[model samples]
Each structure stands twice: as structure tokens, then as C-alpha cells.
Target: MLNILRYLKKHVGMAVLILALLCVQAYCDLTLPKYTSDIVDVGIQQSGVERVTPNQMRDTTLEALTLFLSNEDEALLRRAYAIEDGTARLTVSDSATLDRLDQALSMPMVALYQMGQQGMEPSVLIQQSEQVGVDRETFKTQLRTQIETMADQYGAAADTMTSQMAILFVRQEYQALGVDLDALQQTYLLTTGGKMLALTLLMVAAAITAGMLASRVAASVGMELRSQVFRKVVSFGSAEIDRFSTASLITRSTNDIQQIQMVVVMLLRLVLYAPIIGIGGIVRVATTRTGMGWIIGVAVGVLLALIVVLMTVAMPKFKKMQTLIDRVNLVSREILTGLNVIRAFSREEYEEKRFDKANRDLMGTQLFTNRTMSMMMPAMMLIMNGISVLIVWAGAHGVDLGTMQVGDMIAFITYTMQIVMAFLMISVVSIMLPRAGVSAKRIQEVLDTPVSIHDPAPDKNRDESKGDWRGEVCFEDVSFRYPDAQADVLEHISFTARPGETTAIIGSTGSGKSTLLNLIPRFFDVSYGRITIDGVDIRDLSLHKLHNLLGYVPQKGVLFSGTIESNLKFGGADITDAAMTQAAAIAQADDFIQAKPEGYQSPIAQGGSNVSGGQKQRLSIARAIAKQPKVYLFDDSFSALDYKTDAALRRALSQQVKDAAVIIVAQRISTILHAQQIVVLDEGKVAGIGTHEELMASCPTYQEIARSQLSDAELGGAGA
Candidate 1:
């Protein structure tokens, strides 16, 4: 996982931004519970008030208010209500308006008139109540109602005296109607609900922002990973390509990279969020004195145990799943490429069974991991619900004993659920971790592989500018063995193909014909001795310099998906139209290409599947011809053409490539019958090297090959 994160190092700022935004989201979520608790306990139960009301000092209510009123509470009232000399006073009456006393409501109303001058906050009266002589509960109920009455009449623009007088009379009027208490509770609900709604909207906005940023980062990482892997894969030589097969490399670059990308998004969205909610929930729930903290602890313990068990069972399978996927792709590619041969041989059922076996193996591993992961959510939910029930049961006693409020207990349950949910989210992401980690490791494997065929060291690199390559290719006792083979595929063999000449290699099947041609281009280095071009060891020459002087067409005649002209000009970026047409004419591809409706613009399907095998071979030859290299290597490139087309193409090529070295690996005796030099290989060694006539006379291996494909009269004519 850490290795995978190295790809994301460039986006550290974005990651930090996501973290900050997630913290904001978590704050909004965590804060909402407190508001809910406040609405229940403080908003509803306390009537959203902080001061005593005039109704509480009425003769009908004085007996109840005195019970919970402590000495400090009395002192606060005396200061806030202007109660002096054992009698509440009303100072708001004008100096000339003392006659209004008869209509001034009551003594409580008169005392409230001095609220502003007393400079007393309303909450102090309610908080300092330790000296109350009556039952605390009864006094608290009346005081809450009295405070609500004052809050009701405290209009936005009302002065202190007018608001106090209005509150006193309103309470008296409401008592007559018997509905003020319910109206106050409804107002508390509406105020608390509005604030909660706004906070909830803020949380949704923050969550959306975090999600978009995380998705962008994940997509960027995936793009970078695919690009990196592709660049590395393109540089790999035969040895590296064989070490990690084509199918596996495709899986790593596509499927494996995608897996890592998905996991990264999940980590950014959920992993970062879980910790804040988890720790914050712990702190919030811990402060509640309901004795239900143990339930959260137990739930977490069970969750961890479940995670351990599931991980233990699924981790190994996750590793195997990728390998199985590779196998399925490999088998499928082989079957698809060989569909014709399979049908010709009537092996459809056999191929089907082979594919089914691979598919079944992949299915089994996937099923195990998926089933294991699927079980997790349900079990986690069970634990969460069970903990909720347990908290409510255990906290019921605290609420009954007055040690905990019902609101506090409800909030504690919410916090506990958050804690459990945080862990649950972590566990869900954990399920993806093992599989994605396996994928990350696979992707890194390809990116980290050292190119087996790299450029020579600076000190050893040949200076191409000093001497021009005269297109002289020499094999000095070269031998090559496969990595694990006990014997060499090509033995100690020596030859030279000089400029202005044709050198043809004729060998029986498995006689190292294609292998010998591959060595010239450094597709695989010789195990012993050196192969040189223009008197310089090919290894000492930079790859770019060496390949620039040679044009090679592989035996299979591979072509990419593009226009006919695009395929011809593949490596020759500066090739002109005249040069392209001339090369096509020389390779005998001009006739067929001109016959197509689009001519050079005709599109070639992938692998040249749209063209006939012979046409593909001719186009492959033309592509090499278009490069105009100093040396041309045709590795059995003419096998698909008929005798007439092959003869015409060779004759045309000889006239155009007069000053270049031409090396041909051919199976037909007629193909190399008129070469300037012919080398006959028996097994891995050169049986004979000479003209066609000379080899037929001196080399028995050459004679047998010629006699098998040629009449005695034809052989005699060639030797004559």
C-alpha cells in the first residue's frame, strides 16, 4: 500500500484539502446530535428561557417558586426585579403618573419594570438555586413557565419596561385561555429544527466537495499509472516480455491499475472520515453518565474479531485471484488466436473444457472472497442494532433516577452508533485493501522491471558520427542458448554479409534459422562470441544507431491497425510518397494496394487480419523496404507468396537494393538458388558456406534439403 501511495505523492495538496473538508463534514455530523439533545432537554424541558417570570412571584405560584429558590437565587431576583425592604417595587410609574398604580397589573409586574436598571442576566436566577426550601422539581416547573412568559413578550423592538409589563399581562391572559404552555413548547421545536436543518445542508455540501476532489485524485493516479506501465512495457526486450507474458502484462496495466484506482478513492472518502467520527464519537459518548460506554467497547471488540477472521480467510485467496485472472486471460488469448486451427482439428469441445477450467478456478477464488466480504455488513449491522438495544435498556435506570436526562441518553446512543459505524466503514474498506494491495504489487512489478536490452554504458558506446556504417554484418563464432536450456540453439558459427551482395541462409526445421536472424537486431544477445555491424560490436552501438542501419521483417509478418500507408511508413517518418510507392512496387505489393478502393488509405484491421496471408507478407516486406536501411533482413518473409510473385519481388528488390547487404532466411531451394553466397546450417552449426552449386556439391545436409524439394534435373541445372 505504501508503495502504491508513492504515485500519489504529487497530489499531496489535494489530499490535504480532502482531509480538511472531511473534517468539516464530520463536525457538522457530530454537532447535530448535540442540537437534538438540546431541543429535547433545554429547548422543550426548560421552555428556552434563562430568567424568572412575573407569574412565578404571584400569590398562586409563590409557594412553588420558594421551594427551589436558594439564597443566591433570591439575591439575583432582588437585583433583577428591584425587590427591596421585603416588598417588590415598580419604579417604571412616572413621577406624575402614580395614579396608574390601580391599573398596573400586580406587584410582580411592578418589580419587572426595573429589569433593565438592575443589569441582571436572566440565567443567573435559574442556575443559583441550591437554597430552595420547596421540592426542587416543583419549583423548576413553575420557574420554566414563568420564564417562557417573559420570553414570549420580549419583542424585537420593545424596551425593557414595556416588554416586562407586556409579558406579565400576557401570562395572565394566557392563563385565562389555558394555552400558553403548549404554544411555548411549539416555538422551541420550530427554532431548534431550523438551526438543525441549516447544519445538515452544510454537511451535504462538504460531503459533495470531498467526493469530487477524491474522484479527481483517483482518476489522475490511474492515468499516471497506466502511462508509466505502458512506457515501461514498450521498452522491454524478448527476455522481459517472455518473463512476464503478454497476457499478464495486459492485466496488470488495465485491470490491476483500475483496482488500485478504486481503492484509492475509497480510502480518500471513507478512510479519512472514519477516524474523526470514531474519536469524536468516543469523546461525546464518554461524557454521558449512562454507564453504557461498555456496550460500545464490546461492539468494537466483536467487530475487530470479525474483521480478523474474515481477513484471515480471504487474504490468501485475494493473492490467488489475480494469478487466476492471468491464467484465464492467457488461455482465452491462446484460444482466440488459434480458433482456426482448433476448428480445423475439430477440438472445439477440448478448447471449451480448457477455458471452462480456467474460468472455474477464477470463479472459485472470487466466490470465496465475495462471500466472506458479503457476510461482514450483515454481521456488523447485527452488532450495531444489538448495542443500541443494550444502551437503551441500561440507560433507562439512569433517566429514572434523575442522574441522566432522556435526551442525554438518546444522544449517547447516537454517538455510540457513530463509533460503531466508523469501524464498520473501516472494515468495509479493509475488504478491498487485500485485493487492491495484491493488484498494486502486481503493477509495481512491471514498472520496476529492469530492461534486459538497454543502451550500452556511455564509455562503451560507439561514436556513430566518427565512421559511417558500411552495412557489413559479421557473426564471429556466435552461439546462443535459452536461459534455462542445457544446450545452445545456435552453435559456434561464423559468416559475413558484405555490402553489394546477397547472403542466404538455408536450414532445415529447428536448425536455428529465425534465431540467427534475430541476433543481428539484438533481439537476444549471443551467449558466446560477438556479432558486429560495420566492424563495431552491436552491443557497443546504441540501440537507436544500430536499428537505424537495418530493416528487419519478422517471420510472422506482424502489422498494426492503421491505414495501409501508415503501416508502410511506421518507422520511416520522413518517407516520401514516391519512395513509398517505389518500395511497394519492389515488394510486389503495389498491384494489390492499387486494386483496393482507397489504395494507400485503405485501413488494415488489427494484426492485418483483413488482408490475405500473402498480402500481409508482401506489405511486411514493403514496410521494411520503405525504411531504406543499409541492411535488409527477410526472415522467411516470402513463404506465403507463390513462386511467380516471389521471383518477381526478389528480382525487383535486387535491382533497387544493389548497394545494400541482403540476408534471406528461406525454406524453398528456389528462393536462394541464385544467391551470391549461401550458408547451409545443420542443427546449430554451419554445415557449409558457399554458392548454391558449391554447397550442393560439398554439403550433404544441403544436398538432402535441395533433393527433397527439387527434381534431379532442377538440381543439376542449378549446379551447372
Candidate 2:
């Protein structure tokens, strides 16, 4: 996965932007619970009275409440309020000052209010104290001392109990002062609700924007990866392609890349964001002072354990799943490509069974992994609900005992769930990471493979030193072996195919005929010796220049989907109509091409499946001819043509391309009987290099091959 992340370097700017947006989203989401707690505690419970200090109160009520305060607190309370027209209004607007006053006045105010509720109001107490011969100032001091002692007994919970009681007293004072409690509650609810709505909107926007950017980055990475893989594959020699196989490469290019793309999105969105939310939730819960942090710890531990178990059980299957998919793709490609052969052999049922077995293997592995991974969501939900239940059970006791409020308990639950969900999101992405990690390694494998064949570094001086180019290909003691092979496939081969002549190679099956031709184009480099063109080693030339100097037609007559004109002009856009017509004429394809309704404009199906085998071969030959290269290599290209067409085409080619070197790999004796040179091979070694007459008299391999295809009369006449 980290290897694949190199592709993201190109999109670093966008990825950073996504990370920033995810942070904003986490902030907004984490803030919402705080406001929710406020709505429950301050809005409904206290009738929108957020502070213990009343904004307005009657002068008599203020004076009576202040009696329970110490001299210092009483003086501070008087300074914060102004008595005018028998009503006192809070004069201080600074929030810090108001908060200080709320702390100082809460216990005294709550103690007096509770006494009043039990029929001992401050005014009643003063009257009864005078009746019992107690002075007002002494009575006030005694009352203040008793309230301080009670607060001392409450310890750390004093603030919470005092704040709750003070809010009740503030509500009663607001009612006594004719304040519209309904309007106040409505305003507070609307303000807090409005902030929550704004945060929600902000969260939604950030999430949407972050999601879009993440998708773009993932898509761009996927595109760049696909392009790199394709260009790398295109540069690969036969050795690398054989090592990876076409089916596996296809899966890597498509399925494997898709896995990386998906994981990148999750990495941007969830993986980066989960830690922020989880840590932020932990911080928020700490401030709530609910002392329920243990619940979150337990939930996280369980989640970790569950994730480990599931990943362990499913990881091997995830790795196996990719291989199974490759197998399925391999089987499917083979069946489709060989459908005709399979039917010809009446093996459709057998092929179906083969396909079914691959499909079921893939399905069975997927089912096992899917079933194992499927346990995660239920188990996660179970953990989450269990945590919620535990919090509610413990928090209910705290609420009953007055150590925690209903709103505080609710907020604690929200934060706990947030923390759990954070882990859940990470676990989900982790589950996908194993498969994606496999995919990343697969893709990186293709990208990292070294091409067995490479172009030489440029040298303008060396390039200019080579005089005029006249095609002269020579193989000097060339011994070739495929990669990892124990023995050479072609050994000690020496030959020259010079300009203005035809050199033909003939061999029994598996005689390295095609391999010899492939070396000229540097599809595979020679193992022991060198091949040269114009006295310069072919490897010294860049691939583009080397390929441009030779026209190659493969044995299979492969054609891309296009019209006759397109196929004929495939050599380059510079190929003119006249050149295309001339090449087609020389290949004996113009006659049938003119018979078609659209002639050169006719559409060709993929792989030229719409054309006959003979026509496809001729069109391929025509394409090569249109290039007007210095050398021509025909690898059994004439096998599809009948005797008449082959003879005419050869005759025309001999005349038209007389100045160019022509090398033909032929199976038919009639095809190379009149060649200027014939190289016959028995196995990997050259058996003979001579004219047909010279070979028939000297080489038994040539004589056997000639006599097998020709009667005595034909052989005599040809030799003569």
C-alpha cells in the first residue's frame, strides 16, 4: 500500500485540501454534542436561565438573598447589580465577571431559596429571629456559616448541586420580577438550535467537498497508474509478459487498480478523519466530568479485539481471492479465444466444467471472506449498543444521586458512541486494506519490472558517423536462450540477409525459425553474440529507429479493427493513397478490395475477424509493403494464401522490393524453392545455407524436406 502511495505524490495539493476539509467536518460534528447538552440542561430544565445570577430581581428579594452571603461576596454582588425604582437589574455585562458572581452567589442564593421553599424565607427568618431576641447581622452570619459548612460537605460536587439549585432560584426570581419566562426559553432554544443548525450545515458542506476532492484524487491516481502500467507493459519484452501473463496483467491493470482507488478514498475520508473525531470526543468527554470514560475504554478494547480476529481469519482468503480472480480471468480468456477450437473438438461441456470450477473456486473463497467480514458490522453494533446500555445504567445512578445531570449523561453517551464509531470506521478501512495491499503490490510489481530489452542511450556523434543505410543484416555465431531456460534455443547461428536479395529460412517444427526473425527486431536480445544492421549492432539503435528500418509481418496476420485503407496506411499517416494502392496491388489484394462495396473504406471487426484468412494475410503484407522499409521480414505470412495467389504475390514482391533485403520463414517448399539463399535448420543449429539445388545435393535435412513435399520429377526439375 505504501508502494502504491507514490502515485499520490502528483495529487499532493488536492490530498492536503481534502485533509483540511475533513478536519473542519470533524470540528463541526464534534461541537454539536456540546450544544445538545446545553439545550437539555439550560434550555428546558432551567426555563432558558443559563446563569445562576438573575438579570432582574426586586430590591427586597436581592437584599434578602444577599444576607446569606459573606461580607466580601455581598459587596461583590451589590457592585454587580444596581437597585433603582425598587427593582435591581444586573449591570455587569462582562462574561468573566458574571461567571465569578455566579460562583460566589450560587450557594448562598440556593441555600436561602431552599429555606424559603420550606417556609423560612429570609424576611420571615429575620422576623422570627427578632422574636427570639437574635439580631439581624448575627442571624445572617450564622446562616452564612451553616451554608459554607454544607458546601464543604458536598466537596467537588458542590458546584454542580449549587449551580442546579441556583438556576431554579434564578427562574423563581425572574417570575417574581415579571420577566416573560416563556419568551426567554424560546429565545434560548432558538439561539442554541440555530447554532446547531449552522454547524450541521457546515459539516454537510465540508463532508461533501471533502468527498468530492477525495474522489478526484483517487480517480486521478487510478488514471496515472493505469497509464504507467500500460506504458510499462508496452515497453516489456516477451520475457516479462510471459512472466506476468496476459490475464494477470489485465487484472492488475483493471481490478487491482480499482482496489487502490477505493482505498485511497477511504484513506482520505475516514482513515484521516477517524482519529480526529475519536480524540476530540475523548477530550470533550473529559470536560463533561461524567466519570464514564471507562465505558469508552472497554468499547475500544473490544473493537480492537474483534477487528484482529476478523482480519486474521479473512486475510489469507483476501490474498487467495485475487489469485482466484486471476485464474477465473485466465480461464475465461482462454475459453473465449479458443471457443471455435473447443467446439470443433466437441468439448463445450468440458470447457463449461473448467469454467465452472474456476468460478466456484472464486465464489467459495469470496463467500468465506465475505461471511467472515460480515461478522464485523453486527459485532460492532453489538459493542456500540452494549456500551450505550452500560452508560445509561451507570449514568442513571449518577443522575439519581445528583452527581450527574440528565443532559450530562446524554452528552457522555454521545461522546462514547462517537469514539466507538471512530474505531469502527478505522476497522472498516483496515478490513479493505489487506485486499488493497495485495492489489497495490500486484500493480507495483508490473510497474517495477525491468524490461529485458531496452534501447541504447543516444549518441549523436555515433549516429551521424554511420554513413548511408543500406540494409545488410548479419547474425554472427548467435546463440540464443529464453530467460530461465537450461539450454539455448538457437545455437551458433551465422547468416547474412543482404539488400537486393531474398534469404529464406526453412526448418522442421520448433527449429527457432521465428525466434531468429524476432531477434532482428530486438524483441529478444541475443544471448551470446550480436546481430548487426549496416555493421552497427541492432541494440545500438533505439527501438523506434530499429523498428522503422524494418517491415515485419507476423505468422498470424494480426490486424487491428479498421477499414482496408486504414489497415494499409497503418505504417504511418504519411502513407499516401497511391502508396497504399501500389502496396495492395503488389500483395494481390486490390482485386478483392475493389470487389467490396466500400473498397478501402469498409469497416473491419476487431482482430480483422470480418475478413477471410487469405485477405487478412494480404492486407497485413500490404501494410508492411506500404512502409517501404529497408528490410522486410515475412514470418510464414504467405501460408494462408493458395498456390496461385502465393506465387503471384511473391513474384510481384520480388520485383517491387528488389532493392530491399527480404527474409522469409516458410513451411512450404514451393515458397522458397527459387530463393537466392535458403537456410535450413534441423533443430536449433543451421543445417545448410545455400540455393535449393546446392542444398538438395549436399544437405540430407534439405533433401528429406524437399522430397517429402515434392515428387521426383518436381525435385529434378527444381534442382535443374
Candidate 3:
């Protein structure tokens, strides 16, 4: 989660904007419940009653009492509202003054209480009205007459009072003036409904805007991650690539990045929005003063417990799921690449089962995590519905005692649902987050692995105008071994190949032919001794200078997907068409390339799948030739060509590449028999180094290799 946050910090400003929009959406959604409660409680249920505030009650009572009371009585009545320690006291000198002030203050209180109990039966009404010692019937009848007189004097302004005096005054005005209460209720409902509809629309717009921003930010994050991961993978040398296989790297760059992208979208849209709704729902419910608040807490606790349990069970599976995906990709890639062999060997069913095993492993882990998450919705629903039932059950008693209104009870249920729904949203996103976090850690692993190969200090790097280093390569007691190998693959090897010379290394199988050639280009640094160009150690050269001086062709020729022209120009973008043609001609690829309708413009499939092995090898050699480097290292490049094409290509290379040091690794002894220098290797040790005739006379390893591939006449001519 912290790693995910670090990536999000790159776009903090946009994330803040998304949060602001989501908050606006949540506010608009939460506001609707309050308006809904108002529509029910005030607009419809209390349409005929006046809701007078304390200020209105005080002002109206003062107006009515001014004509009858003295200044002292007025002061005493005003002090009745200013209660000390919860008791309202009027400072009156005599019974007359005290009675007058009491009458003035009691009028509004009695009117307000009577107005509130209007819908009750007579028995209930008598008990609920103010506790003055008057007969119920006479009190009610006189109360109505006094309220009408007050209304006639005060006019319509009497309806604004919160006290019972103002309520009775408003009731008297409505009855006498013949106003329709039902019509008033309808008008208020329509106004409240219109406001609710407006808010809902605004909420919808904000939600749409938030979704768009989330998608944009998530996609940008995915793109950025892919770019960085790809660049990092490209910079990795053999050691790093070996640490993480090709299939796993592909999964990390593609599948893992997609996982993080989806989670980012959910993080912005659902995860972030959940807290605002959850906390805001809590605040809204609290302000409504609903007595059933504990139900929401209970539901959240149940949800949290379920989430914790499911995560504990499913977290391990999520981590293993990615490795299974890598296995599937690895198996699938192997089957596809080896399809012909699999078919030839009649192992179709076996291969099918092999693939199915990998597929089933992935399926099993996915099923576990998905099935665990699936339980959440049904469980949350049970909690939600159960909470709803509890709220209604508890709230019904409040309604019976008139402690809570029907509308307030309904709003409480809605807010409770919102709170639980918020938790539900978070739980759903949380399930995905753990998986994405696993993927993020995997991606971070790739980005964090250091490259094995690095350049020397700037001062120690190679210079262009230094000695005759242009085409000279020297191996001084060089030895190398794989990372975990028990012994060296190449041991105590020393040799030098100078300009205008073809120094061919001839060895039988497993003699470290390719490994020895790879050292000159710094593909793998030597384990024992140093290799040099001219008189300077190869490690002292910057990678750019080192690679720029050598043209290396691997044992297996690989091509990218593009036109032939693009493939040739890949080594150097500045290679001219004439240079490309000359390189192709020297590699003997010009004939085949020109045979195609488009020649150099012909399209090649990935890995040169469109071309034959020999054509691919020729194009690979042509690509290296186009670079025109000072040294050429060919690792079994001629193994794919026929003897005739091989002879012609080597002849052309010998004449055209006179100034470059050429090192060839070949299994065929006939190919290197005419070279100026021949180094024979036997089991990673240098058996002999001399011309072909001298080696055949003195070295048994070279004689054995030469006698196996050549006729007596051919060996004799080579010895001449």
C-alpha cells in the first residue's frame, strides 16, 4: 500500500482534484436525506401548524401585554425568559403585577402546547395540555375564542410563532380565513421534490466527472509503469535477465501493470469515496439525534470481521497467483516454439495435459480468492437488512412515545444503509488491493534490481586516437565461469587477433567456444584475468566505446519484426543504402533479399520467422556488417549455410574486412583450415595455437578434428 502511494504522489494535484469532485458528489448525495426528512416532517405532516421560534414567542407576548402591564410588570415578564438554574422567575411587587405578567407569558406557552396536541383524542388531549387548574372543556372553548381575537388583531403575522400561543393564533387565522391545508402540503412537497431532483442531477454529474478523472489517471499510471519497467529490463545484463526469466518479465510489465492500473481506478473511485460517505453518513445520523445509532456500529463491526478473516485466508493465494501466471506463460511459450517437435513426437495429448495442469493451477488460485470475495456481498446484505430491521424495530417505540418523528426514523434508516454500503464498497476494493499490492511489489522488484555491467571511471575510459587499438583484441590468461558453476568454463586462455587477420577458434562440443568469444565484447566479464584492446584492459572502456568497436553475432540468430531495410539499419541509423547493399552482398544475403518482390523493403516477422534459418543467419551477419565495427566475433554463424555459400561469403568477408580483427567460432574444421591463425581448444583448455598445417603436424586435438571432417587429399592440400 505504501508503494502504491509513492506512485500516486507523482500525480498528487490530480488526485486532490479527484477527491474534491468526489466530496462534492458525496455532499450532494447526503443532502438529499435531510431534504427528504424535511419534506415529510414539515412540508406534509405539519403543514397547518405554525413553527414559532423562541424569539417570535417573546415578541408576540410583549406586544399583547404592553397595554395592561406597568413598566415593572413588563420587566418581570421579560425576565421570565431569562431562567436562572432552569427556573423562570418574574420579579413582581404585588399579586396584581405578578398575575398580569404570568398571564402574558403563559398565554404563548399554553397556545403552543395546545396546538401541538391538536391531533390527539380528548382524553389524551386533556392530559397533554398545560397543567393549569381550569376545566378541560371551558379552557379549550375559551382558548379558541381568545386565539381568534388575537388573530383578528395581529392578522397573518400571528402564524409565524413557535409557541402554543402563536400556533393557536395561526390555527385560528387559517380556519377563519378558509385556507386549504392539503393544497399547502402539496405545494411544499413539490418545492422540496424539485430541490431534491436538482441535487440528484448535480450528484450524477460529479460522479461522471470523478470516473473520468480516475480512468485518465489510472491509464497514465499504467503507461508510466510499463515505460519504466521496459527501460529497466532493457538495461539489465545477462545476470539480471537470468535472475528473472523472460516469461516473468513479460508478466510483470503487462499483467502486473494491469493489476495496479485497475486498483488505482478503484482506489480513486470507490476506496476514496467510501470514507466520505461513511463518515458523512455518521455525522448526518448523529445530527438527526436518532436513538438507534448503535445498529450502524454493529453492522460495521461485522463487516470488518468478515473482511479480516477473508483476507487472512486469501492473501497467500494472491501472491502465488502471479507465479502461476508466469508458469502458464512459460509453458505456453515453450509449446508454441516447439510445436513441430511436439507434433512429430506424437505428444499432443501429453502436451495438452501439461498445458492444462498449468492452466488449472492458475484457475485454482483465482477460484479461491474470487470465491472468498463472493461471500462478501451476501454477508453484507444480511448485515444491512438485519440493521434495517433493528432500526425500524427500535424506532417504532420512539414514534409511539412521540420522541422521534416518522420522517426522522425513515432518514435514520437511509443513513444507516449508506454507512454500511460504504463499508461494503471498501471491502470489495480491499480484496483487489491486496492482489494489486502483490503485483506492485513484483514490479518494484524489477525496477529495483541493479544492472550487473557498468562502465569504468570517466578518466579511465578509452580515447579514440589512442594506439593501433582499432582492430586489435588480446585475451591474457582469461578464464570465466557461470554464477554458480563449480569450475571455470574457460581456463587460462591467452591469445591475440590483429588487424587483417582471421583468428578462428576450432573446438569440439562443450569446449567453451561461444563463451570464449563472448568475453571480447564484455557480455560476461572474465573471472580470472583481463582482456584488452591494444594495451588497455577491456574493463577500462566505457560500454559505449567497447560495444561500438565490436560486431557480435550470437550462436542463435534472432531478428525483430520489421522490413529488411529496418533490420539492416538497426545497428546504425546512419548506414547508407550503398553500405547496406555492400554488407548484404558480402554476407551473401543480397541474392535472396533481391529475389523478393520488395527486396530490402520486404517485411520480416518477429524472430525472423518469415525467413529460413540460412536466410536469418545471412541477415544477422548483414546487420553486424552494416555496423562496420573494428572487430567481428561470429559464434557459429556459418553453421546454417551450405558449403558453397559459406565459401563465397567467407571469401568476400576476407577481402572486404581486411582492417578488422575477425574471430570465428565454428564446429567445422574445414571452414577455418585456411585461416592465418587457428586456436584449438579441448575441454576449455587451449590445446594448440598455430597455422592449420603446423597444428595438424604437432597437435593431436587439431589433427583429430581435421581428419574427421576432411578427405586425405583435402588435409594434404591444407598441410601444403
Task: Report the C-alpha lDDT of model 2 over 444-555, residue by residue, as the tens digit.
Answer: 8998899988878676324555667799999999999999999999999999999999999999999999999999998899999999888888888888888888999999
Per-model TM-score versus the true fold? 0.83, 0.96, 0.85
lDDT of 1 at 708: 91
Q: Candidate 3 regions off by >4 Å?
A: 48-50, 53-187, 463-469, 717-720
Error of 3 at 3 (Å): 1.5
lDDT of each: 0.81, 0.90, 0.81
Which wins on TM-score, candidate 2 or candidate 3?
Answer: 2
Best by lDDT: 2
Clashing pairs in 3: 52-161, 52-162, 111-164, 111-165, 112-163, 112-164, 112-165
How far off is residue 689 in model 3, in Å?
A: 1.2
Q: What's the count of clashing pairs in each model shown?
A: 4, 0, 7
C-alpha positional error of residue 89 in candidate 3 after TM-score superposition, expressed in Å? 29
Cα shift from native, residue 151, model 3 (Å): 25
RMSD of 1: 9.3
Alpha-carbon runs more than 4 Å astray in model 1: 50-188, 717-720
Residue-level error in angstroms, candidate 3, position 520: 2.4
